[model samples]
Target: MNHGDTSRERGRRGATAHVDTFARDHLPPPDQWPGLDLDIPTPPGQPGPPGLRHPDRLNCADELLSGPPADRPVFLTPAGPAWTYGELRARVDRIAHLLTGDLGVVPGNRVLLRGPTTPWLAACWLAVLKAGAIAVTVLAQQRPHELATLCDIARVRHALCDVRAVDDLVRAEVPGLRITTYGGDAPDDLLNRPAPEGPYPAVDTAADDVALIAFTSGTTGRPKGCMHFHRDVLAIADTFSRHVLRPRPDDVFAGSPPLGFTFGLGGLVIFPLRAGASALLLEQATPRQLLPAIAEHRVSVLFTAPTAYRTMLDALDGHDVTSLRRCVSAGENLPAATWHAWHERTGLRVINGIGATELLHIFISAADEDIRPGTTGVPVPGWHARVQDEHGDPVPDGEPGLLAVRGPVGCRYLADPRQRVYVRDGWNITGDTYVREPDGYFRYVARADDMIISAGYNIAGPEVEDALLRHPDVVEAAVVGRADRARGQVVVAYAVLKEGAARDAEALRVFMKTELAPYKCPREIVFLDALPRTATGKLQRFRLRGPAYPGGDQQ
Candidate 1:
């Protein structure tokens, strides 16, 4: 065989460093993929945005590690310890050797990384990409069934898991999966594996090669695996982190979302390294744990859900969180009540955003003085968004319609037919019902499935939840539509009350009537100690819409 023939054929198909082509083979057909604007040529003599441009050969892990100074701290723990860029790169090199040499892994293999947020887990992710493998990261809290489902969808072959969190992975018993445990003194431990390395060179992969597959956090049905490219990882930083969040080299980033969630990955790992800043990784990031960690680490940037921000307001008496300069909220809609309360108490405006697993990170956001309390901000730089009707036609600025967006990065599902449903007419049709304001800001209404129609009127669930949250005694609230006899569907409220607060459903209804119209009021109220949420802190409204309980009654 002629050597030129083999090399030229691979280039003709798609330039890649992957020896194993499973991920590439399973990608959606070119016709099913969303329109990526990166392939469009820039006009002559006119320059494009710096972050949107990438060379034919690229590895994102290599790019992120190249820019920062050697001795700058890149990873910080809540306890007293830090890892400089030099130290992280060294550890990553050693692990890359262990993966390719000792573990017999090859390029394009799917490596599952399961663990809590720590320096070790982050290093494994970077090493996998450096070794020319596709990373499939799942939460450490995933049970055996969930783990198996994710592994099956991604067709994972190998795993580098935390020793303490290995039980579920073992129990999942995915066929043909090889596992290497870390954070233990065993001879077979990943960190203890034998390796010979000075500096492990990153794989020379194409910019469009698949780097990771992130499964959607299931709110309704099966989770679809969203495939992201090497350049897509850097695009989020160039657009959102560089232009909107505006991270500084001296800033310390912290968050409650798990690293498995793209929100946490962008905020905690990729953005900081890309910005030459340090990030504080927490294994447990509940609101109570975050308070002390924030003061201890002197965290300047924070990311979490709207509910956590509201809960922290009650417990902020003795904490010293003055180091916080910028705050970002996503994973769920941020109510106007929570935003105003947080501003009144701390004088910091919470930056509200809307992002999806398909899009990887936040695409619509506003920062600092550009923030409008209730509306999610305009499309981020390097992206375009509009409100469109069912036929993919633009709606009036003040009308509620589906939000469609197109940018450098868009959805590419892995061998899934839902790709057609998510991407239509060159736009990623996000299933959120929204109204584009006259000033171009987008206002949240509800999920397309969450909208309620009762007695010839359309009602948005979040509007009712925001009204209920204004009540002094209502600590948490969720609104869903229930089947009714007269009306096709009626609004129902699930609420959690504060300690010593009366559980009077009628009084709460009257309070809501004052804040909203009569038809918007909840006809029934169910009290629970806490609202159900996914591991990523997203509200699970599907669980609330299940069959009514024994004592359930209309107000």
Candidate 2:
């Protein structure tokens, strides 16, 4: 289990173990990268927090999975029985052998993983890292065009896909990419291939070596590749999971996010594995499926979005959910109403967090007694956060400004010029508009781009949407600014109503006038069956501002 070499041979800035250097070559210049506060020496004579401290020559996968007791269950799924740590290690070792021996995968090569959430898919991800390759994990349901774009950006050289999900990847037709399938009887299947047995030694990658490349979910425009190092993976588990979530070894983790999403990756895989706990890997975890699974499996920790929590509340009548002790909400703002409702019903505080793909995982969050219903909690123990203006100067409390963060983990876009925009003056400006209360809690405003300016007033879309969600008949809501000739823009709302509820836009507007300022009320309401969302379930606000509106594309 030891992942250390002599400091003289492999220090933090010493030679890397990678054979291929594509990831190292593609990293943004050191000056352009956000300040990584990983190993900076503490000021003379001052004590430091015991976080992010690891050997210079380390592989996170080796550290996470190598030392657990041989017979403890690490993964549980409805499709089959639990996978003990011994079984998982055997599978990962064999896969690692196949990766290096048969697949000709060298260190630093990028390996794409496309599959539903399952033990086999998780094993592939670990094998890629154990072999010193960069993992590019993506949604299995992504279309060919999206897959092609991602492969082109990451220059993926190999892929291990579930047999059911390999067609779109083959259709992507990425040149020079080798595809290997699993979960089938084919001679070329990854797990079925021959390999040396027992334990496979882990690659001695330097702490700063790129271990994975995560892409932004394309919520704004073209997705950007984010390069994360081996240490970054463990940093999230140490800072948030250790200091905040505090999971025990016996806890059973469950969640709705896919393993490809960083939220899902942390909640379902990294956190549980690091804590020596078991996670129930679900391929399809909607509200309907999650409720029953929680009751049946005695799940202690749950992770999902605000929308899912609200949906589950409606279906909670007959389900026995006392097994859940921790519920986390992210991927979007957790409206105060939803938080209060969930807390009242389950007697568990919903930990609200705000994170970005660029930062790897949740940077700001709260748990237990530290929970604040309406605000995203203070920065995790190892991180620092503040409200700052565009000039990178701190803003006063109670004023809305950009959320600036710097910690052991920060944004490092792979060869993208937007690096200059995301990291400025050593701080990762999260592009989130937030208000810092005098008491130190960070309040969610909206995405900086989602702010609506009408005439001379500034408004946050989430504020209006939160007000609309208070209506008993409203099931879902998304607010955006539509172009208007008089005011520069007008507030417009898209809402989904309950089955038996009236769909009168005017009546809803009248109700909103009572809850929000008149200017914040929706000028026009668009009724829809469901709000538009990306494959990852993030709301697509731009679609609501299309060319149909007057000032849609403002001058």
Candidate 3:
């Protein structure tokens, strides 16, 4: 109720009061770490321009249309040849006109996009934005039922899909919706059609207008749509680029995240365009494909998850990656060993951050100069972060608590009461457990929902996973909590060994004991050919918590 405590001391006291009274009984002490300078210059209360004005102007196509024609490539897709910025802009403009004039699409319309990471998908996304319509990019791997639910929730009337997914789209049976197909060797009738000449009127939209709707992993329940405004794109571009990436106009960006995911969108599309740079879009971001794309495109900035980075390093015996200036790892907790290995091999520290679909992008990330390996790093400019207890009170420094954030762009879920659970008193409850050091760096614990209580001692899954990853035999590992009658809940690990490595449970148990506290060590290790993952390649820990694996030991 008393939200006007602008004084730093008063705010800290107020936050502390909330935590001590409500959340302290449920959580652990924050890990002791170095402190941060609280006096660092904070950005303006609301850093970016107020509201989403001229949503039409934020489209990449608009920037391309007004910029000069150059020989430089704007986009390079594996499905087809590259296109210069000038040429890409022209195509986007023509497509935008067709959607608006011929297809009867107008400003504020919701268009569902279902496809792989192809050139056509990228063009359609930009064109939808250019037409002032909200683009909802769904993962291609989603089933028909999932697609139907998403379409209904977003009120999608038009869908742009690839031929491969047309049957699924049809099976979805979305009422009163129209579907269009693209890609393959067939000639595109839309491209050769007459170009829509002269300036089409741009829609006037505020910063708050929903420009895109990104859905989170529906692990707990149905996926919720996280609405991001046009300004949200710029917010990430400004915060991440200024403080973290610092890319130049000439820098070529490349990564493995799909175009639909925020990581890929920010790194491949928005970040590069914001800086007047270029992106080499890969339809298939396999390790083999990605490595060559980087070398062939001379990619300077690389963005991906930690697992991918580890895979790349293992496969990089003769890969030429000298052009790389920066590598960013997110979507999962980054192990310190991964950071050290990358730095040793490439002479670059992988910048680590913790972001969510709700926040639109990374809210707490470190710059190259400020990185502390294994930690998620400090809050970015225009954002405020605090580790708070269960009752929404600030936890003590070095203690783990819910990571709360408030920034220029916050969670605005469409028509969901779950918004109350995430956005409380203007702070976004990130559902992640973290510890803020005295020096300001934040170390990741586990998701509040993922913490395992064994013999009354709370353990974070990632911490154990981080320790296991350091072992020579472990290539990939997932730590999860399994139900145990004796201990309430216990830590269990699913490990995937590197090629030709023998997996011995007894030996691994010894390995973990030597590396971690006895209470934090995995009670059992199950060797698997591969860990189950979401479409985005994130390890699905929920699957491991099954009846078959009771007592944290595999049957």
Residue 400 displacement (Å), model 3: 0.9
Ranking by TM-score: 2, 1, 3
> Candidate 3, residues 1-555: lDDT per residue as tens digits?
222222331123211111112111211111211111222233446334323223323443454345535566778765567787766676677778877877777777778888877667777888887787888998888889999999887778888788776788899999999876765445543454455786555454444355788988665678888877666677777676655687887898989888778888888887887677888887778776788888878989998889888888887877899999989888888999888888898888788988888887887888677888988898886567999998889999999999998765667676666776886655779899999999998999998888999999999998899888999878899888877789988788889999999989899988889989999998888898888777877777777776454334453
Candidate lDDT (C-alpha), each:
0.88, 0.88, 0.75
Candidate 1, after superposition: displacement of residue 205 in Å? 0.8
Looking at candidate 2, the ten consecutive residues that score lowest on lDDT are 1-10
Task: Write down the TM-score of every candidate.
Answer: 0.95, 0.95, 0.88
Put down candidate 2 lDDT per residue, 1-555, tens digits, no spaces: 121222321224547888898888887776676665654334345346545767789898888897779899999998788999999999999999999999999999999999999999999999999999999999987999999999999999799999999999999999999999999998878878888978999999988899999999888888999999898999998888877888999999999999889999999999999999999999999989999999999999999999999888889999999998899888999999999998888898999999889999998989998898989998877778899998888999999999998888878888899999998877899999999999999999999999999998998999999999999888799999977789988898888888889889889989999999898998888888888787778998887787643324543
Model 3 off-target regions past 4 Å?
1-70, 78-80, 184-189, 192-195, 548-555
**Segments in model 2 whose C-alpha atoms lie over 4 Å from true places:** 1-12, 39-51, 548-555
Model 2 — TM-score against the truth? Answer: 0.95
Model 2, position 96, has a per-residue lDDT of 95
lDDT of 1 at 177: 93
